[model samples]
Target: MPPASLPPLPLSTAAGYQARHLLVLPGDVLVDEVETLAVSRFAGARWDVVPAGVEPATVAPRTAAPGEPGVLRTSRHTTLTGPFAPGPGLPPGSAMVFDVVTPRERGEAAFPGSGDRDGLGRAFPAGLPEKEERRAVDWLVEAARRLGGSIAVDVPSSGAPGIVLTPDPGVAVDMTLYSDVWLEPDAAQAVLGQVDGRIRLAMDGVDWQGPPAGIADKPLYRGEQMDPAVRKQIHAAADDVDIAALTSGEPLDGYGLLLDLGVDGMIAVEIGDEPDLPFLLRGLPWAAGGAVSYRVRWEPDDLAASQDEFPPMEYTVARKRSAGIVAALAKALHGAVGGEIADEAGFLVEPDDL
Candidate 1:
């Protein structure tokens, strides 16, 4: 039978819809270009680019008492995070955070009780462009609406800028910017447009590769008793192909070492209990190629034991969730960077299950 046609998920009904909108605010021109290229491949649903120092606002001191010299009074300062509370529309998750600092600010003293020790606070001499910042915010708000989501911005006391999105229940999108100066409106919009185009491509299935072919060579390996002529013939037949060689007691191991070999996919054949296949597959770089599969051989007794150890139900759910996340992230990143394929690190979590 022919393969089933993939169904389309409207932005509103997408499984991980919240993670689909990506915001990138790189302070450096070179780094921003690289990140933009990386994100474009996945086709981020909504992409925004702004100055690096922008962030979502947290609590800040409102005002000081009138006529009070050197005595500061605290008052509540209104910020966007107040209205955007964490809820079903905004799920909690962790991400690996990175920041860039200039040489002048590298040795700046931290506040007495700074919560984040790694945070540097030297005031770099760069003008902030308010108009451009507002434009970025406007782009985000419009994008969110198109995706049936909401936007949240953070402006912290440390003078950094942040952008966050609450696209749906149980998901929150956050990004920070730290650059020498604010980005111009033209440049920021150009980046956003690039991302928008890529996201469309990703949604249309531009980056997927079909399943790979099975192992191309047989006899696994020739024995010493085999004639040299026969062995040479077998090796010749296996040329430019992937073949697995195994030993009875040796831990199964083989390397694909052919020069200029173009592999469309990969499969790891193992002689072990099925339960061990998952762990073995984890060691392979599954993201590098088009497709990946696994084949395992086991003794009859081992197979029975492994059957009990493997949780087929849970595996199926996990697999589906992972696939959904991959697709969503790929589309989102492609949208953000203008249609460039993203690296493995970009898909940080399984959006559906999260």
Candidate 2:
């Protein structure tokens, strides 16, 4: 959907602070259907019905008041023409739109307390609390079961980038903060073994290879196996603790690795960290002090032209395979190293949630 048609959700109206999510359906859905879904999904919760295009602020503060029952205004749009047309990567067709508005102070059920913190007590500044975002995403996913479409986080005014949630199952995976702590080579290898075993068992046709072709010959960016500059910076920033001696040998046997899951995807596991001190981990409250900071990325294999034309089912299969491997790798690392993980979309990913 175009930004122009996507009205920015008001941060604060007379109704107090609020948040909204957009659900785009493949076909027109009746307002009654939307109402039923809302009622069923949020049973016993108060709901205030409003006409289409009604600003949330104009509504009374009954739902917005502290400790009062939360209010949700569901607005339906049947005519998805012009700027409201469905964009690429979304289901193509005439679309139906629904805007679901909720109060911002929904507490831990919707968001985390203060700055985003994990079970390990790591806290970091996040624009939209990852916990709340995950809760909203759960609703969108539920909506998709009945509505058959896509969802987007409508935050055009916040200066943050727009986030779209879809089941496109695209051929890419970028998991950040996969591990908050680094393990010794032996422990790292054990984690790798667990991840490798899990991936192989979960995905039927996965093939593992040592590094990508020519990576060994290339000038290493983050380390020489280790970088003197990075070592000095780490030592200085980390109260003179020798993180290098702590990490010792390469993680997962080698810094470079690959997973080929047939023609659908080719995922590269790049293991390393920032050359210099990362701003997020520089000072106090630096939770990921021992982080190895690896990244898992994927792309279509050499037969890109052929794979690009594959059907939706193929794409979804590829996505599932790649996503599963990334999840397994992350879960294993978290279990071994003790830290949090984030998904491609930058939301905190709990290992148990996998």
Candidate 3:
């Protein structure tokens, strides 16, 4: 049979243009295999495929899936199968797959009822849990090794707490903050309050209605409506406070502090509307040399339109920015940490040398 064409959907659209890697959720291999072959044959693009399964630690040892032929190997990719369980509450069946592609590849349409309904207003289709997603991510990382491609995982900032997998010394792993979860004023304040005594606060681009003391010297780095004066105030506040640490919502301009800024800890905030923020946060501390943690909060919304719009406009904007930051951070940090591994990958060698 001939390979299938890219699906008609947002993921497919993004994958077709922007994706450097393709991740296929478990139980969806049929779709992925068909699409991958089609893309390779028709589009003249080669995609690396990785199978998904539960880790041995999590699931009891079991045979590979039926007709899969245990651990198929090829020059382009490797495929493995096992009794891998999906995260909690995932439908009875779930698996993971990886398809490494370039920006030129297109994506297929969302599975029927598998995505949020258009105009539904913040309504999302039911999905699997975190562990399930993590399994997919882990598979991608492993796949990177066989395919000689860099691996990056998108996670949330608040949920940034997990055991780090030390990849091959030279191999670079990217940890990005997923920014779909909104931090409401109260929630943000509470997080700030938690670190009030432990660390001083400051702001870079945001404004305060009153004295800096009102914000407890906590820096609101790179936020909405932030200005130069606000940044100055944050700097001044940093000097006054003990300056236990520094964090930014995103990498700053003229902010060489990240490399030389001496502090007990440093955190890069990943804000987004996606639920993946926590995963990213958990994975970052390992990528960067530091002891780090994340806090998540969201604003309450009361919209009487469709069930889809409840997340509020402010939350949506924040989420978009958050996702962008996470994507940027993943690329940057991956280069910083995994440049050597990427070099060994060979495909990225020219880019690195340049």
Which one wins on lDDT? 2
* Candidate 3 residue spans exceeding 4 A from truth: 1-309, 339-354
For candidate 1, write residues 1-354 as lDDT tens digits: 101221121122112211122222212222223233223222221113222322212222332222211111111110011111122222233111112111111223434433321111221113211332333333443333323344433322232234444322111222111111222333333433342322111112254232244323334465536665675676656542433222235542221111110121111111112221221122345322212111111112122222231224543343343334334433432333221221222222222322
Task: Give the C-alpha lDDT of model 2.
Answer: 0.46
RMSD of candidate 1 to the truth, in angstroms, is: 25.3
RMSD of 3: 20.6
What local lDDT score does residue 139 receive in model 2, on the 0 to 100 scale?
51
Off by over 4 Å in 2: 1-149, 152-172, 178-180, 184-187, 197-254, 262-264, 274-284, 288-291, 302-312
Give lDDT tens digits, candidate 3, residues 1-354: 111222111222122222222332434345334333322222222223222331221122343443231222222222222112222222233343333322222224334533221211111123221232323333454433323333322211223212222123222222322222234433433443443322223234553334446463344654555565776777667655533333334442111111111221232332223322222232354434322112221211322211231335654454444333333433433333242112211112122322
What TM-score should be assigned to candidate 2?
A: 0.38
Backbone clashes in each candidate structure, one number apiece? 50, 2, 54
lDDT at position 171, candidate 2: 33
How good is model 3 by TM-score? 0.21
What is the Å distance of residue 319 in model 1 from its true position? 26
